[model samples]
Target: MDNSQRKLGTPKLGKWELFAYGQLVVPMAVIGLPLAIYIPPFYSGTLGLDLGAVGVILMLARLSDVFVDPFIGRWSDRTHTRWGRRRPWVIVGVIIMMISAIMLFVPQGQVTNLYLLVWICAIYLGYTLIEIPYGAWGAEISDDYHERNRITGSRQIFLLIGLLIAITVPIVASQAGSGATAASAASRQAMAALGWLTAGLLPICLVILLRSVREPVKGHSVPISFAAGVRVAMRNGPLRMILATVILGALASSINAGVAVLFFEHVAQMGSSSSVLIFALFAAGVVGSPFWVSIGGRIGKHKGIGVAGFASLAAFALVPFIIYWVKPNYPGAVFPAMLVITLIQGFSIGAAPILGQSILADVVDLDTIRSGEQRTAFLFAFLAMVRKFFEAAGVGIALPVLSWIGFDPQSHANSAGANFALTAMYCLVPLALWIVSTTIIWNYPITHERQARLRAALDRRTARRARVRAAD
Candidate 1:
């Protein structure tokens, strides 16, 4: 058994295929964006879940991702279906997303703390079924490093779009209902709409992937024990660095996301439309996302990522200073200042995933050389777990500190300490962490030249094997 034997088909990505791959963003965002942005705030403020309780539930829910991701990833890797290794799981994940999105909206009536925790656990588990497989599918679908970046960029863009749409839910619901208090009905309606919309878009995009990209077959299962497989992957230096940078970056970003609502609602006084403002920044990132990919292609992935992280650090570090300088000094100019910070961040945020995926592609190539197996999906699963754990730790630590700082959602503005916490989390802390992440990336060993060498060797081996088969 060899890589060639595992494939159902090999087709170049055509325009429609690209479109389909890009369309996956919708489902990804629909299913994922709300958990971070809307769910926490809604539970804490609207449903009367205590901030501390909300934080605990969120932390616990994210931790569940650690267990679920690898299991699903490993299963998806070994799965053989007429539809293909990735698509069947991709479809199943979407169906689960449709159901769970609805579950999230179902108001479990005045519940005990235990009941609420149980409901939250269910939601988190369902989300893992959707997210982990979906991410692995992205990695598995393309072997070309640049093509993978394009696919990932398209995915991230749609993800941003989904975030934009999700952000509008509160506003849309408010307008549909009489006011904020009764917007749950409106939200329910929105989720229903999103559910069907994602369900529809997913299959369509997958068709594009199915039709356009020919997956390399997992023709031969390595005889190595699974434990040995795990060991080989863990010991890979390039993969480890990529994982480290991603975990650190995810931690920093998750903490920033957890605190951003506070910054917008209280510090900036964006009011009920604060969600819109925050999402618009995300949308702006979606808009700017391609440039990052293009930059990576131009300068090389590692340098491109370094540049993007540097920009994010600068933008994040400037937020508080600009706010303080402009708020009383030039009241009307505050929005502009905030916009500047967000606009820059939008471009910078895309760097990690785009570069990370490219690096992962290289790791896949390397793994084949060292371990004599293509277990890209398995490695991605490992990443899925590491990413979830650190993200949990980030939100876990930040939320409790925020609660202790008296971050009452009902308060018109946070108390001075609460304000300090929000500002620091959103601005200062992330800026510092981004700097550290970039420094780690600077040490990344996979150069474009190295990738070229690996690919050339793989190609020659493939060609020689083909010639041997012909002679036989």
Candidate 2:
């Protein structure tokens, strides 16, 4: 069948296609979970590298993407092959990730700060290749507003599932060994397991996705230079608003992830149960995805994000109080209280990425109408860069700050001041950023009504182009 025929036949993606698309995220989460949560402490505490140096290395590695992301994005948009524009990059990314996962996750003899820096940079480069194109691919899958939610929502569910699996591996691996493993040893074991899991599942998932899902046909449009494309994207008001929220939300999430294990271990006195707690957190996110998506449909995408942000803010606000005050009064209540708080926070986690990307897809429509070019991947690349840069920044800033404050990850006898610093970094910083992000996005200009009007105008333009071509 021709491209138009295929597009007409599948106005909505089939379940199997969504399933295949979502599976790709599973391995990504497996790799990502440890990088954000486990790897910092593993390298610094277990391997005896300087904590501050490790943070700087990771942050610098992500900074490399400042040059890398936009290039990959523009390349993917311009690429044409029998396999497809996005898939070819995904193929290259899988190979890069597989090799780097083995090196970083399953380290060999004499690991050092330099070793950590090199391998981490390699892995992040691989991630950018896949993530930029993958996001653009999803945005192209369907034009309907709600269908965009379904596309992103499906990915969110699988992303959470992958996170659950990632955490479960370490919990099972640590428990399966001898009695009472040290935190550092447990983290090392977890990394090894995660390495194998990622290497094994990544290629298998890639094969399934490539075989099952077909890329959509590209419509005719005016081609623009990269410089011009960047200029046009800057002028897009909705894109700016959405990206502003993305920066804050992603920065908040990165801060929380960077220090979560440390805070739980040192502050909440829940080190041994860290994986279980995280598993519970992401599990709640899995269950809550559908509810948040429904809320987006009911109220509006931006408002739904606002509600989730408030829920997250409330949950984060309780952390310091629970650990510092409530624990002193009723020691037994801390874990239960923290568990409830974690669940509440995770439930709100699904809305940001799910609804945010949906909003971004609409913004892409607006840009298309104005610029007369389809630059979905390029725009998605900018979002990905912001997320990675800030995620790295969060770890980069948090770890060094903790070190400067004399908080030792290996020592149990951290001073009261050090413990309080960890708590504030984990809780208060994210809470403040979430408040800013929610405020910026709560009144986003693109609603369902506005998006429908944009789509109609594009449709009219497409029809006009067809008539002119026929006359010629």
Candidate 3:
């Protein structure tokens, strides 16, 4: 078919197709929560690895993505297959992730730091394989300004649901057996259950997604060298702006996730309620996804993200104060106050994943217009790599800092200074990062009108190329 005919024939993705695509995030989120929140504690406290070592090892594992993500992105973009560009990579990722999940989550014997490093690195590699291409696939599904919001919004909703399931699984598993189970043993049980759940759900979700959704027809696949792609990405102003925000924002989130349980258990003195609180947080995100999407439509995507970041900042700013002031004076009111703050922050959670990704899809259009090649996956990979780098940095920094401050996760009691340090790291640092991220993207230049123009230019360019080929 000709360019015009293909453009005319592009189908609006049905709800079922969107749901099928979104379903894949469930298993991924299942693994993600444990990696971010539970893994360090599990490996460090239960499995006898040092806290600082776990932090550094996980950081190194994620750093491995520095090379892997870009290579996979470029390879997937250049790959030609009957199954399509993105799907095949996703299939391979599923197999790798499944194997790694079993080994990492369900450890067999007395595993060492090296074992943790190897399996965690493998899992992250698998995650990169799926995430970079999976994100690019979603971007290719639609080019509409508002429709992109819908696409990402759907995925974000599922993502939150998956996180909620991840949180609930441990809570339920911990409670299912004798209530007297030691914390470490309970954690082990939870991880084992999660591993099996991930192993079972991944293939099923993959089959459904592969069967239900058709990959979008490629407009063109001009193979750009990795160096050339990097050069092009460097020159993209919007992409640079987005990456800056991604680094700051992801680092903030990583720190928060790294020390959240420590803060709740040691600083806040509410260990039992941590799981429920996290569940509430993500449940709020599930509810807030569409609200942020609507806000994105009414305002602009970047401004919407700025607004959400501000909201989160306000919520985080209250955390340390609440722990220090409210807990001592009216100890009974602390959890309720924290619950309120967490829900508020959670409501704003949808802004980044839903809108940030939608914004990146728009940025991809800008790059395509400039480079005359569809490098969507490569650009997404670039952003993903930046995000992972900072995320790893956050964990790498937070844990060692905690260890240095004399905060011990294995013990119930910590020094006042250590508790203060946890509070500051968990609350103040993220607050500062969010402020910077919000400032960077508040007036992002690519408005809806600009993206429409970019799309038009791409269409004209495609049509011109088609005519030349016809003439030949």
Candidate 4:
């Protein structure tokens, strides 16, 4: 909006803005779609990493995030440039991610034990560089709570589309082959192709976001030091609650991703088609993104999140009993329950990222009013750190558990240990994490009324400053 036309409660986003925001979601694939869901099993089965080693490698990568994400967010916050603070970092990050994805698939011969570890580090570093800046940008672009939801929701829809395409392509390639053995080989080749396709699209998305979105004008000065910005954000109760919920919620979702494939393939023994079904389940979450976002705005962010979390908890809780009860008595029932549970999990997790993130924007504005600083990017870095930590922790736990279960993936569905491991991973771990997240969110303090007051108060201050400059 033009300077004179802007007012409190003004719609901060237009069609173009929403489009650009949606476009931003494309890059989420660079960081999210692969590692959290697809890569662990891919590395273990395809690239020849053992389950235990794969788990350790993932843990190390997540630990690295603790060190890098905050610094990256701080850098994006402190940067002053014509391209805007978050955009420049995003550009750098995208380039890094593209390189990492390429490196991820580079064919490796039978190798030393360290092969997976080395590649995982490269992948983690690349993703952290890209995602931290990309996530931070979401908060910098809009101050409206609902607008934040719209932008994030639109971004999520395209993100899910990217995920669906990435996932389904491999399945289709596998199916096109002449036989079962050939199908697995064909699927691998298709996966490589899909990686390259995504690599190609990454730059296109970067250009679209760079050319399309304009960062909103800042009304007041804020210090840029990392320590100062973090201090400001931590002091806010509402932001802290949101950050805590995100951390716990992300942990649950990450654990589910790490384990779901194992669950379907081993415990359920549903065959090659199960991969496609699982992908569909993951895609289900993405499809429901807009619905979740709208729900958050219509009710409230906390209430919406609480509802989603409850659904996820219930669905995951039932998975174990369902698997045990129906797998022997009624094999057909297993697949449907698996699909339903995963869909519920996806819907809840997908909504959390979009809606929980919108609250971060509100927190930044509230901080701006209370402390007179605009350090949205830096504040969000803490949230990113928490998210990264939990994803790693999930992998850390899953790897060893998978090992203990004797997940001789080459053996397929006959391994009892593998079957038990899958059930534990998908059903139990997620339920525990969901419970914690729900509790944390129940007491979250940023109501619509409180946020509106913060916005109105900030607007009046800006108006007064404008009048002073005019009189002078």
| Candidate 4 segments exceeding 4 Å error | 1-12, 108-115, 176-187, 346-349, 413-418, 461-472
Off by over 4 Å in 2: 1-5, 8-11, 181-186
lDDT string, candidate 1, 1-472, tens digits? 2323433222334555556666666656765665665566666766667777777777887886687676677777777887667767766655665555555655545644565566556656755665656666666666665766777787777778777766665456555654553224224454445545555665566565556554555544354557787788888899888887888888987888776766777787655545545665787788778997888777888888888878767777777776678776887777777777777877677777777876787788887677766666677778878888888887787878878888786567567778888788777877777788899997788877788787676666666767877899
Pairs of residues clashing in candidate 1: 6-217, 6-218, 7-217
lDDT of 1: 0.69
Instruction: State the lDDT of candidate 4 residue by residue for 1-472, as single tens digits.
Output: 5422433355666777667657755645634565666566677776666778778788887787677777777777677887667777777766776776666654456544566566667667766666666766766566677877887787777777777776666666555643443225224565566567667888888787777766655555646456666677788888778777777767777777786666666677676757657576657877788789889888898788888878878887887787788878998888787778778877776776677777777887788876676666666777778877887888888768778767775566456666776777777777787799898886778878888888888888878878988999
**Candidates sorted by lDDT, descending order?**
3, 2, 4, 1
TM-score of each: 0.88, 0.96, 0.96, 0.89
lDDT of 2 by residue, 212-231 (tens): 87788887788898888888
Query: What shift in Å separates residue 334 of candidate 1 from its native position after superposition?
Result: 1.3
Kindly give the stretch of ten consecutive residues in candidate 4 with the minimal lDDT sum. Answer: 178-187
CA lDDT of each prediction against the hidden true structure: 0.69, 0.85, 0.86, 0.71
Model 2: lDDT to the true structure: 0.85
